[model samples]
Target: MSHASEVPASTPTIVVTGAGSGIGRAATRLLLAQGWNVVLAGRTEASLLETAQEHSRALVVTADVSDPEAVQQVFLAAQSHFGSVDVLFNNAGIFGPSVAIDELTPQQWDEVCRINLTGAINAARAAFAHFKVHGGGRIINNGSISAQTPRVNSVAYTVTKHGIAGLTKCLELDGRPYRIRATQLDIGNTASDLLNDFGATQGALQPNGERMVEPTFPLQQAAEAIAYIAGVPLSASVNQLTITAGGMPHIGRG
Candidate 1:
């Protein structure tokens, strides 16, 4: 009669990108609290450290996901510190300043595409390779409600999110034979800094050129949903999950 605590240190190791704030931070905490070792990857050491405070199993790696070499080092650091990487919460992303498609500069579009779409691809590739070496692993990508529906004045951001959905589906198919499982969480209107700022500022912009504050729920709800996906047996992974505010327009609104 041995409990999970008996071999807790042998629990799965997870890598979390964008671990500095918001959803990444919340997911890292939830994973660590569940006795999983987490590698914190972010450009900011201070914020990553803050998320990993006083946790011995947490390893902090400063990384910008858009850089190929930097992305490699993050996984290398994970292997170096934790012996192996069993899961990757590929959550690094940014909502570039909203602007109409006609006004969005080429550079602006490139930057968002590089970080949001290319970045997720890089992390997933690294995770897939690592999983092949280690026998198996899980990848949970942080997609957005934008994947299903474009947002007002969010041309660049919405396009990148749609790319993430396509990537997630491809990974699910490509990784199956190698014991690598991929899942996408299409999140919306969680009470994070980004959503809160939206609530305070532009609120919700309707397709008909109106604005209203969309409802929001606790960040923990999304984090916990991720944990649930990660906790399931590898043979039974959740391919896609959408968690959003109860009253969000994602359900129906012009």
Candidate 2:
């Protein structure tokens, strides 16, 4: 971690969890390019370093968002390196075992809740505390489309995402007086490694028990949307923003 003295005080800083790949990595790269100090926090140190790519404004911190202590450490490291953290991209999550409700084990459910829901809450708690003291900040959560709708054999993932939606609302209500803003970015299919199972040729499982290929947009577009929200001022808050492929069957998803 670089010392706070090394970075200019005026530079805006954002902490991005799960910054190793996919949307998190894309957003981090774009933020760094746009002259923001970024703190890359993820489970894999090597992957976080790769995301940082030796950027002078990037600080790599390895952390599993499920662990509250580790998540707190991420904020501390960010503040120590950049003087203050202005935003937190709460984007760490995982799709648990794809099994029906009856077939899903308790351990599997607990594991998913621990990371997807608990992890997000932990990060938000830390960010809220920091923001309250520093005047204000923004939190952009990667809620995913599952936050509003469910897919077959995705009970664990779906439930946690719904929890994220609730968390976002609570943060918004609670942070109003402190200038802390919260936004939930629900994204649909995007072109990334995580979508390999639901690729154009592979096809994803549909609500009616059939499989169909779903349309997807570029990863860069999703990244740009996040950047736009993060750039919004505290006086104005984007409570919720949903982005999906034009041809994606989300609006009328069964």
Candidate 3:
């Protein structure tokens, strides 16, 4: 319970990372529709532009979240365009190579850690710094149910998402004094480009000589959930939220 009521609204300024695709893109569209001045940051300019084109209210910027310099520029541009950012959708992440840890390459591990974990750290750091000075802001990290339940071939992804849960908790504690609210969404399978990219999802060979991909939830459902979280006032914050596909086997997952 920090001094969140101190600032008057002139339309909330928000920054969303990984805005080029998936949940990020969907969330961006919702925010723009609500008239929030949103800055879209991601590695791909083409995708960013395409996302922005769908909504005239979006400010598109190409940024590699893995780089600190690039993140700084993103912040500067957001502040320059919108004055102050009231919330950060820290959603950039990479679901690393699906393989056993023993078979996973060091390079692959590094890439996942860099994007999913370290990249989150960088974004949170920059956003917190700005928020602290501006009195307070909200942070929402895109976590995965994998953090709680491990997937056999997704070691790196699980590890990074676990780190994200820790990140969210620590930030929630540290940010309380500054009126900065932090939360994480531990999402289960949702319809997105990431799922479509899994080559064997339709049916891939497994140890049992069978391939199985879990059913996916509609992307719109996840998008709506995210928007609801974002729309919550500073007085009340959702510390953590987990929304998954109704029929998904996450409850029984190892």
| Top-scoring candidate (TM-score) | 2
Clashes of 2: 0
Candidate 3, residue 251: how far the Cα is off, in Å: 1.1
Alpha-carbon runs more than 4 Å astray in model 2: 1-5, 197-201
Stronger candidate by TM-score (1 vs 2): 2
Q: Compared with the true structure, what per-residue lDDT tens digits does model 3 show for residues 142-210?
A: 998888887657889999999999999999999999989998998887888776444334742344545
Question: What is the Cα-based TM-score of model 1?
Answer: 0.93
Which residue segments of model 1 deviate by more than 4 Å? 1-9, 196-202
Clashes of each: 0, 0, 0
Q: In model 1, what are the clashing residue pairs, if there are any? A: none
Over 4 Å off, model 3: 1-9, 197-201, 204-210
lDDT of 2 at 154: 85
Error of 3 at 123 (Å): 0.5
CA lDDT of each prediction against the hidden true structure? 0.83, 0.89, 0.82
lDDT of 1 by residue, 77-163 (tens): 777666788888999998886779899999988888888988999999899988988888889999999888877888888889989
Ranking by lDDT: 2, 1, 3
